[model samples]
Target chain A: METFADSLDTPSVVVDLDLVRANIRRFQAYADANGFKVRPHIKTHKLPLIADMQIAAGAIGITCQKVSEAEAMVAGSSAITDVLITYNIVGAEKLARLAALARKVRLSVVADSADVVDGLSRTFAGEASPLRVLVECDTGANRCGVASPEDAAALARRIAVAPGLAFGGLMTYPPAGGEAAVQDFMSKAKALIEAEGLTVPVITSGGTPTMMHAAEAPVVTEYRPGTYVYNDRSLVMRGACGWDDCALTVLATVVSVPAANRAIIDAGSKALTSDLLGLTGYGHVLGRDDLAIDQLSEEHGRLVSTGPIGLKVGDRLRIVPNHACVVTNMVDEVYLIEAGQPAPRKVPVAARGRIR
Target chain B: METFADSLDTPSVVVDLDLVRANIRRFQAYADANGFKVRPHIKTHKLPLIADMQIAAGAIGITCQKVSEAEAMVAGSSAITDVLITYNIVGAEKLARLAALARKVRLSVVADSADVVDGLSRTFAGEASPLRVLVECDTGANRCGVASPEDAAALARRIAVAPGLAFGGLMTYPPAGGEAAVQDFMSKAKALIEAEGLTVPVITSGGTPTMMHAAEAPVVTEYRPGTYVYNDRSLVMRGACGWDDCALTVLATVVSVPAANRAIIDAGSKALTSDLLGLTGYGHVLGRDDLAIDQLSEEHGRLVSTGPIGLKVGDRLRIVPNHACVVTNMVDEVYLIEAGQPAPRKVPVAARGRIR
Candidate 1:
């Protein structure tokens, strides 16, 4: 069988356009059926074309992690008008950039404290439009968010009255299996914010693992799922997706087979990324599930099998990395495999490395 | 007590040129004393300016992992004329690119099998200059290279008689603390190749943890050390270098203080990378030894402490990541901290994502 790995150069990310569209539609259909607006996060593919596909498929808007990433997405695709940055925007430089980005798109950001809110207010206080700021709540993940529902309410009130800012809603990157906890925390926060006479327009939560049960959190108006567009090994292991649903795979060529059961591929941390996500191996080798990606240096990944490995130099393998989001950020561009196409189209990951 | 994080943007890699110069000189002095040439691997910093600095500091050449990276390094700096790609180059597109690169600079590559040797020969068969090919020996690293010294000599002979290939030498990415194994394998391989009447002018070995003992293998003529330019937590923990010798640090701003002992920083896997390198935490927070970077999301790092974490929102901290080489590849550019300069200079990592 002619595979994507056969034609492409080694150590390149190949996105099946067919799979991406199917994924976008599947999530959109689920959100539509469950009464939630889908704001596909560009953090997965980082390609404006993919963002355009999401928007065209009926996404409410897009989500980005950084101000520069938002700016790059906005610059690359005119279809993206609404952006919600789900991180606390800090620093005068980033706040200024956020203000500048607000002019191009309908920009909304999140904050859990007055320091982040004050910084955003300072930059946009004199702008033509008020910036929408969401109060991030800690349902359970504990990475970033307000401590309690009362704290979330307080921050919401603070954002509602802050100059050149409006209270958008509550957002949380909740635990994988904590939809009930998310609902409990967000409902209380929403009720309290409403009790204070503040309108919470949106309650957003996301994680591919808990996506199917997202309707359990009835208070959440929007769902921002990134990796669903390019489901990876972590999502697959979580039962969020299967091998057939993975849109992106790292195409790598075997470089050496020094032992009976051991071979090395050109893809490593630099190509596949080192995001283990609690898995034992780095990634799942497509069609070669018996082989374990035992070790990875910077530019080489070691594959070992229980038997003779059955591999040779120049043999290509498609790898579904443990996490798709970080792998997308490792390359400058990715190849898109399409149906009935002679060659895979090259698409630049426009927002790649926009971490600042 | 002004820190490197005080003056620059958050989530940026800051390199102290002074410390880099010291590291270069220290390693060069050791290599010079031991009668070996230093070939600095650009895989660590990926900056042409750093490559130039290494060349000026007495590096005989530069080591790159991919053909496109070598092309970018040569394009960005005129000083990098001698290039050695340590990874096996496969596929036609890359081979064509490599052949084109050899036309401009003195280029060499490594191979452990006849498939690779024949590919290199086919690419350079009619060129005016033959491509220098090295036989990679597996000195127990098990990542790549021929199985044994006999296999190394066999590949060396294959390259020596190839249409337009010159047998450069033997190369190995040896296991840490296995200098004696490297010495035994390389000496035997050298003797075997010499008995076959082929000139083996160079024998290269590298690994940051065993860098100090590289000369322990007296037959090794050149040492290719990548991480020595920017010693990281791994090196510091392994006794390869001290904390003061570290040149690169990730400057991050605390964005969320969700609990008394848990704080979150803006830098995550995207900025600092997820390379554990057998360590417990993601990185070593400068001057904050009590804190542990327990978890990393795509955009958030969770820092926890046994006691109440003193870090507040908007506070800056310098983090020495677990693996400096992978961390450097995460960002598009890094800020150079200079001694007398008023502001840190922004240097583009020209070869950051040239994985192919």
Candidate 2:
């Protein structure tokens, strides 16, 4: 029998459907047992099929980083009525797209600055359906969002007063291992918003590393964890998931055994990506912990052996990259490996390359 | 009048057609005067239109790293009869594809090990025409290829004797600033191959940083420079080309100005790529050398100001990424900016995800 693993091309992204389903069910069950609505971020897989699977597994909605990404998911699944775009949408083209997307789905966006909210207000004014806006709070992430809770409350007040824009609570993507700070910040911001006669309905806080502890934040009503659908080396290093839980991998072939203790694979920075995620090497070679992907060019991955590696040319190896989300975006299509199936199903990465 | 720059979507790969034509002509002229064949690598751009442009500008053939990439280019241009695949083609699927490609075009491949040549020989045996094989020599570049000159000659002899395989010559992707070493190695390998009653028809050696000094290596008959057509920040830092010579840039919009020194752009690692290429930042912000793209999430690029940056939300900035080739592979489509065209023409990246 020609198995799917044997027939597929080299340097391809393979997702184990069994593992993906298990991951989705595991996270959904955790959220259900607690009192949180799970809104999985589609940025990890960037596939409409995967997003649909997530929504079918009890997710309240989907979360996307870009307007085009949200549009892609919404177009794929009629069940995906609610979408939260976590990045600020700028420019006339993107704002118009956002407005159009809002007309189709229950769309809400996050903004930390007055300019972004003002732009959204102007674009959505005098529409039959008002646009929902959430104040993005920086709870120790320090990446994007308002720095202080007072700023978050002020932004909420601004959204409440802005025409054709309804204040839709607060959202925060806290730093890994900083769930307590997120709780403190969200509670303070909610209190301030309530004091200003604004109703805070949804308080979203999430990061894959701290997803299990999300219910500890009593004020958080929704959680958005993207990478839990397909764990990676970074997640494993953070003690978030076991090695067996890594569902996605880059199946690369050893193209050249140039010298002793050195081999080259077809997967390079273009496939494995250059996001170190604080790890030492590029990726983890499955079943060969002694081998290290020490260097990468655009199309060549250099694998250095820490110990004796008995790999030869044409040998295929599955590598768990440092970050799964970035790897998903690098490729156009991925194979879904179903258990006991002879051929894997190919899935198009629908929401990929949607940086706008 | 609306300019092409103003009409483009944020975080797009924009290529200046004039600069691309100038770059191709300049490199081809240099190689023509130096008595070398300019077989430009298509991995930099991966578009059939760009490959056709290179052939129109006097490129002898096209060089690709994967079989599918070569197939895409060959399918696009009938003029692209000769293609040099610089990576080892492994597995039954790829070998069959290689055989099919060989039947269509004058295909040649590089191999460093006996196993690869054996596989190719088995796959191409009994065909009407034999497949050409080149011994890949590692001349200071420790990535792939035989380590010693003797090994290169041995591989050449092996391919010469193998059924359905003809010994073409030698090929090497030398380390940057190692032109003398490549010359010495190729000369020694050529003498050994000749001593075995074999003809050294062609010797190819190239890398963008050392392309200008290619003529110093008298034994090299062909040069393959992938990044010369679209110079990037790395090429500029290495003094290979001036900043103005760069033909590609990622147009990004500032989406958030959260702090005094921090501004966030819509282009993140997905668009700009994490290829530092030994540089300090992810990319060079055009006209703003003081600002640094110090951090990158999947969808957010964090720009930190050395001093005060007067950038506001919705301001668009063109960033010259550290590595243009990787950035080209990241996006699905790129815009071609002509000097007189009001709007840049959109070109789909035909061979973007052809990793196999």
Candidate 3:
């Protein structure tokens, strides 16, 4: 009766807030020990409650990817003063929004070019205050940012002299190649930016895969790792975090035991997002690695198990999704479970669907 | 400002309701000519307005994938009197919910076993009315359902005799390879069910791909195609609909022209829902087919083109996401465009985050 196993309601997202708090503490401790500032990315959790917890755990600030996400967080807590938007702010309207946000908090953003620099300059010109800007370096991701240190330095110089703008430093998302390359690139960029007579004080770089190694690298002044708070199947596959370290789990109900080897859960792609991301399957069933959640309908998760899982109809199972960040955006609320508790505290995912 | 090209927001879901209406009319016309009831699945749009439009245009009822979706739709309108859930109803809790839903509307569900039948029977035995059930056949998408026609017929027989249960008919999600085989099996199963003196009224079969072909197939009395209303990149790839027929698009801003050939948009896995389903990339840029949206960060979409796209800062583009259903789940509201206009009537995706 206490379990949600008997419920037939499909396409709902379930969260364990207790696990989220533990994750926050763990990541905070890691950052504290490494002498790097912890700036938890709100892009992963998207909940204001989770963001508050991260800040409460002694995080320097929150890292947001969108202006809307930043706006949502600002609405939740004016106390969260320092926020770094880890995305390129281009376009007139977006820069205007960014400029407005900058007026409220200690706002900083990443950029990769002169056009982006010009866009920000035009939007923030003649303002009483200015927006902090970081020149994004490619760092082998080959996706965004300047490919070379020279390009980064060139942008940094423009940012240093641009009206209503301050050059914060350099930023990059290292592609799983590791710390040596990122450190090398950051060092060259920092030297180049300083050579251009601008202070590159805040060097930021860290992804879930590079978190452990990022602490060992000295050039990065701040590390922002989001997924360490919710170690998913993808993070586990990459050896980023242990299964025990995974704090977020999708609670689902077994709605059908159609075949001896096959069972179906009410939670599907709609609940646990079908983002396999090169993984073998949709998600990993907690405590049952042998069971494969092989197929996902939008509302029904097709679970196939060769072993005796002793799973029956109406049994509630917790699933660790392949990617947790995308899953956070799909729901409006989440539950925070305290230790040894029957009921978790209900908290609204206030920023859940702020996709703009 | 008239064209969607001038929108201010990035990663926005733009639906051409005109195209959606046209698709609905086309499907309704096909179903009317072919003598099959059109039960348009609400899983595609997750919009009650669209579902109501389909019903107004001659849909007999509607198909809901999730209990929450069905509950929301039923709550929204009194005109939608009948709903057929195209999923297995399992577990005591879900059965009770299903029973409660049956009280308000003529509810029908699909199942593949005696356990589910027994669960439904037990839950609805004392109710004023009985629950209608359909035995799901493993037509082609070997994801779920009974493997043999004999098993399906036996399950149907059990539903007929069980208290508070009525055997409706057979249902199948037609996979590409086994349409003919499924037709042969369903024909035999229909005969077997009829021989048992049971009313097998609703023989439902068809997905978006085989929807047209299913109408001509033997023993398919109803067609339930979800994605025809909003043709996606995947559907276009399958040749079910052309690019012009695509009703759904994700409007995004070009956030970064990082390199000459590569640009990054503010939309990524969060906006596009990383449900690749074996397509080459996340989405197809409206005017640039050669530009492949090959990489996705949580909030950044990396577009790779052979040459410079002539894209600059402040440029907005519409992208047809690889999958529309998953995209709908990511946003709180969507704009209903008449002719791809920037200022379109905004429609709330009412059940946007109703996962469970």
lDDT of 1 by residue, B203-302 (tens): 9988778788878899899999999999999999988888888999998999999899999999999988888888898999989889999999878999
Q: Could you tell me the TM-score of candidate 1?
A: 0.98
Candidate 2 residue-wise lDDT, A67-102, digit = tens: 989988888877889999998988889999998898
TM-score of 2: 0.98
Per-residue alpha-carbon lDDT of candidate 3 for residues B122-180, written as tens digits (9 for 90 to 100): 88889998888999988767666888889999999899989998888899887854568
lDDT of 2 by residue, B81-122 (tens): 999999888899889899999999899999999999999999
True-vs-predicted CA distance for residue A1, candidate 2, Å: 14
The residue pairs in collision within model 3 are A6-B93, A6-B94, A8-B94, A11-B355, A11-B356, A12-B355, A12-B356, A17-A336, A18-A337
Q: What C-alpha RMSD separates each model from the true structure?
A: 1.5, 1.6, 2.4
Off by over 4 Å in 1: A1-4, B1-7
Error of 1 at A162 (Å): 1.8
Candidate 2 backbone collisions, by pair = none
Clashing pairs in model 1, backbone N/Cα/C closer than 3 A? none
Determine which window of 10 residues in candidate 2 chain B has minimal summed lDDT: B1-10
| TM-scores of chain B alone in all candidate structures, in the order given | 0.98, 0.98, 0.96
Total clashing pairs in model 3: 9
> DockQ for all models, in order?
0.79, 0.80, 0.63
Each candidate's TM vs. the true structure? 0.98, 0.98, 0.95
DockQ of 2: 0.80
List model 3 lDDT by residue over A177-198, tens digit each.
4688778989998898778677
